[model samples]
Target: MLQVRVKPGIEDRIRGFFPWVYRAEIASLSRKPKKGELVVVRDFGGKFLGYGYINPDVSIAIRILSFDKEEPVTPELIKKRIREAYDYRKRLYINSNAFRLIHSEGDLLPGLIVDVYGEYAVLEFTTYGMNRFREVVLEALVETLRPKGIYEKANLTAQKVEGIKVREGPVYGEVPDEIVIWEHDLKYLINIPEGQKTGFFLDQRNARKFVRSLVEPGDRCLDVFCHTGGFALNMKKMGADEVIAVDISEPALEVGRKNEELNGLSGIEWVQANAFDYLRELDRRGEKFDVVVIDPPSFAKNKHAVPNALRGYKELCVRGLRITRQGGYLAIFSCSFHITEQHLLEVLTQASYDVRRQVRVIAKTFQDKDHPWILQMPNTLYLKGIWVEVV
Candidate 1:
């Protein structure tokens, strides 16, 4: 195996169990290894540190695979990690089979995500190392969970950044054209082969349930950017009077409508249109709603775009507030890691000011427990939700 020699001070971080060994931290390398090749990491004094996967191009040069020198990076290790991850999920008391099983670095398995939807498992690999472990990891899941189907949903950009090519489609079990699953007492369908991030946002499960708790019978609810109708289906199940789910993608809206039916919710109205434009039109028409949900995609993938993303988010909140009835509730969210909780709250405050409305925060929430956040890593807590009452 190739050897990666760390700088004088680099041993401190690696010894402290820090997962990433950036390129700058390395003083030298004995030999150039293939991307994702397992390498022995050592300090400048030639003291053993650990084993890890190397990627020559990225700043995050190597991701430590194991701390124990004896622990082989074998299929058995993958099975053990998979087992531990599953056990942790079951402990959460979330009976739904549709949830995140492994949340990449959060689960101590960086660059990999495993979402379980009933009998199927959707795996997304975000790094070359995880991609190299694909077969072993899939075998682990199959042997441990005995899932009916498993699929791969590789992140093209992440792969590209790691100097690797994208590999699409099933890597193990047979992946059908459409996969059905249940969440928050509602049924939904997904096409992992072409669907966004395994065809649904299972991470939003808890937030949708929280929104449902605020719903009342005879209440008219509007769900903006209602990807696959998560909030809409939850509200419908909560016995809302009516539901309007809007999204830009016709195919996503179709999936949302199908999910509404799958959940036995026939009262939902699906609208295919841009959420921002729809909200503006509603404002112009003097339309009002008892409850409104604004859950848009990540507007700021890069830190530099945070400013514009905040502006966009504020505008959505402003429109949502304008169309909300007096004393109505607004469930707002920001999935962008760049948009900190404080920043989102400030944006919402400005939005309230724009509508000349006084709003009181009812509740605040972070990402669901399924997407575990490492205490030292604030980035893990990306999703933020705040319930506000327009007074």
Candidate 2:
């Protein structure tokens, strides 16, 4: 393998298992390394640091996979990591068959994501280096899950940045367009070929269940960006008399409708409109709800977008706080790593000040146990929700 050396002081983070080696950190290379090629990473003085794949063209040039000298990147090692990830998930007692089986760096397999739904598994390769192990990943997934089918999803940003080909669709066996999965007494229809983030937001499983605690029977509730009715249906299950689910995607709303009926639920008003617009309209109409959930998609894809994302989140928080009835509950979430929990709290404080409503934080929830995050990699803890009670 080609050996690569890092600049002085750069090896400290790598030794601390930071995983990523930036292009500017490299001091010398044994040869002109090809993109997506396995290489040995070393300290400035030639001591071995770790084993990783090199992507010479990108800013984050290398993603270290194995820190052990004996554990090089191999098919067997990949399979072992997959098995270990599975074992960890098994111990999670996630209360649902649908979950994230492999969380990339969290599972020590950067650039790879695997989500299991019923008997089907969805895979996404977000790095060129990891894409090279597709065959091994698929083989391991099949051998471990023995699922009826497997599907592949594309990460468009990764494709462009890592120079990997984007191939989305069924990769193995027979995968139906939709599959049904259960979560905490609720059944949802997952559109594997079309839904967002591997057919469902499994990371929000705990948050969805947690929302039920603040709901009371016959209460009025609003679910913004309520894709597939995860929150809306749960509100109804909690005996909320009136529930409104809003989303811009007509297709997602259609699935939300199906999910409602699948759970023998009725009376959830599914609205096909932009959540921002709908929230404003609700405010204009003097609407008040006992509970409100504003779970928007990632508003910031990169650090450069954080300012605009915070603006968007602040607007949502303002509207969410206004529409929530006195003594009621409101929950706001950010799925972007760039939007920290502190950002949400800061935005909420400003929103509350502007709206003149005193608020008390009720709870804070994060990605479920199945989607474990590395402490060193804050980005791995990408999802955060803040639940508050309006006073």
Candidate 3:
């Protein structure tokens, strides 16, 4: 195994269990290191800090997997960690059969993600190091979940950034192109191969349920960026008189329509348009909704994009606030780690000031329990939403 030593000041964070070691923090290496090679990380003065995989070419040069000397990185360790992750998910007893089985670093399996949609499990290996453990991962997933099929979804970032060559589609048993899964009295039709983020946004399960509390039988609701109508369906299920779901993708809108039909739901107007443009149009028309949800895709993939991402968020928040009825509820979510809870609050405050709509936060939601995030890595807590009542 390759050995790496970090600069003096970098040892504390590594000792505190922060998994990543940036390329610049590295002071010395035992030898010329290869990408995706297992490496033991040490602090200055030659003290062992942790064990991880070294990816010399990436900005995040190393991702630690084990801090204990006895618990070195191995295929068996991957299997055991996976089983532990499954046991934890089972303990959650999430209302939905579908859940995030392994949340990459959240599960201490840095660089791997596994989402279970009923009988099918979708796996994404986001790092070359984790990809090397694919065989063991698959074997463990099978033994633990006993899913009808296991699908390997190729991640674009993994290919371009980590240089991880991947194979898409089913790697075990048989997987169908489409599958129907139920969550909290709502059934969603998932296009496994085609849908975004492993066919569904399981992270918002709690927020979807929480929205039901704010919706009344005769109130109107809007779900912007409503992929497959997760919030729209839940709003309608709560007896909202009218629901409008908007998204940029026509195929997603089509799926939203089917999902509505799948659940014996009707009257939800699915609109194929950009959510930003749609929200502006709604505000222009003076259309008001009793409940509104703006769940946009990550606008910031990296830290450099945070400023522009905040602008996008502010615009969305402004429009979301404008179209929401007085005393009604509005929730704006940012799925980017670059945009923190404070950033969201600040954006909302600015939007509120601009729109002249005094707001009071009713709730703040994070990714559901299935997608656990660790305190050591704030990036793991990517999905955040603020539910405010427009005053």
Candidate 4:
């Protein structure tokens, strides 16, 4: 394997279990290395740091998989990590079969994601280094899950950054276009082939269940960016009389409708439209709801986009607050790692001030336990939801 040494003082973080090494941090390389090559990283004094895979072209040059010298990156290690991740998920007691089996760095398998829905598993490789282990990953998934089929969802950003070529389709066996999965007495149809982020946003499972607690029988509820009617269905199931779900994607709205029928749920109004515009129109029409959920897609893909993302979130908070009846509940979520929980709280405060509405926070939720995050890497703890009551 090629050997690389980092600049003085850079090894401290690696020692602290920070998995990423930037290209600029490297001081010396044993040789000109190829992308996705296995490498041994060392400190300036030739002290062993970790074993990782290198991508010379990217900003994040190395993703260390093992810090122990005894444990090196190998096909067997990959399979063991997959099996261990499976064991962890099995103990989580997650309400649904659909869950994130591997959360990339969260599972110590950098650049790889695996989500299972019923008997099917969906995989995504976000780094060329991890993509090189595609065959091993598929083999491990088959061994551990014995699923009927496995599908691969292409991450466009990863393809662009890591120079990986991929097509979205089945990698093994036959995967159907849609599969039904149950969560807490609710049934949902997952379209693994075309749906966003590996068919469903399993990270929000806990939040979806928690939102039901705030809904009351015959209450009016609004679900913005209601992909597949997750929050909408829960509200209706909780006996809310009127539930309005809005999303920009007609296909997602269609799925939401199907999910409603699958759960034998009625009185859910599925609206296919831009959530921002729809919320404004609702305000103009003097529409108000007893409960409101604003769960938008990630507005910031990177740190550079955080300012605009905060602006978007503030607008959503302002609109969400305006349309919520006094003493009613409202929840706003941010799925972007760039948008911190502090940022959400600050934005909510400013929006509340601007709207002249006093609000009290009720609860806050993060990604469910199935998707564990490392303490060293805060980015792993993505997806934050803030629930408040308008006073």
For residues 1-391, write the lDDT of model 2, one tens digit per residue.
9999999999888888999999999999999999899999999999999999999989999999999999999999999999999998888888998999999999999999999999999999999999999999999999999999999998898889998998998999999998999998999999988898899999999999999998899999999999989999999999999999999999999999989888899999999998888999999999999999999999998999999999999999999999999999999999999999999999999999999999999899999898888888888899999999998
TM-scores, all models, native as reference: 0.93, 0.99, 0.98, 0.99
Query: By summed lDDT, which 10 consecutive residues of candidate 4 come out lowest?
Result: 192-201
Higher-ranked by TM-score: 1 or 3:
3
Candidate 3, 277-376: lDDT as tens digits: 8888999999999999999999999899999999999999999999999999999998999999999999999999998999999999999999988898
Candidate 3 — which residues are off by over 4 angstroms? Answer: none
Evaluation by lDDT, superior candidate among 2 and 3: 2
Q: Give Cα distance to truth, residue 386, candidate 3, Å.
A: 0.6
Sort the predicted structures by lDDT, highest score first. Answer: 4, 2, 3, 1
User: Residue 335 of candidate 1: its Cα lDDT?
Assistant: 87
The TM-score, computed over Cα atoms with residue i paired to residue i, of candidate 4 is 0.99
lDDT, candidates in the order shown: 0.85, 0.94, 0.93, 0.95
Per-residue lDDT tens digits for candidate 4, residues 157-264, read: 898899999768999999999999998889999998779889998988999999989999999999999999999999999999999999999989999999999989
Question: What is candidate 1's local distance difference test score?
Answer: 0.85
**Which run of 10 residues does model 3 get worst, by summed lDDT?**
89-98
- Give Cα distance to truth, residue 383, candidate 2, Å: 0.5
Model 2 misplaced stretches (Cα beyond 4 Å): none
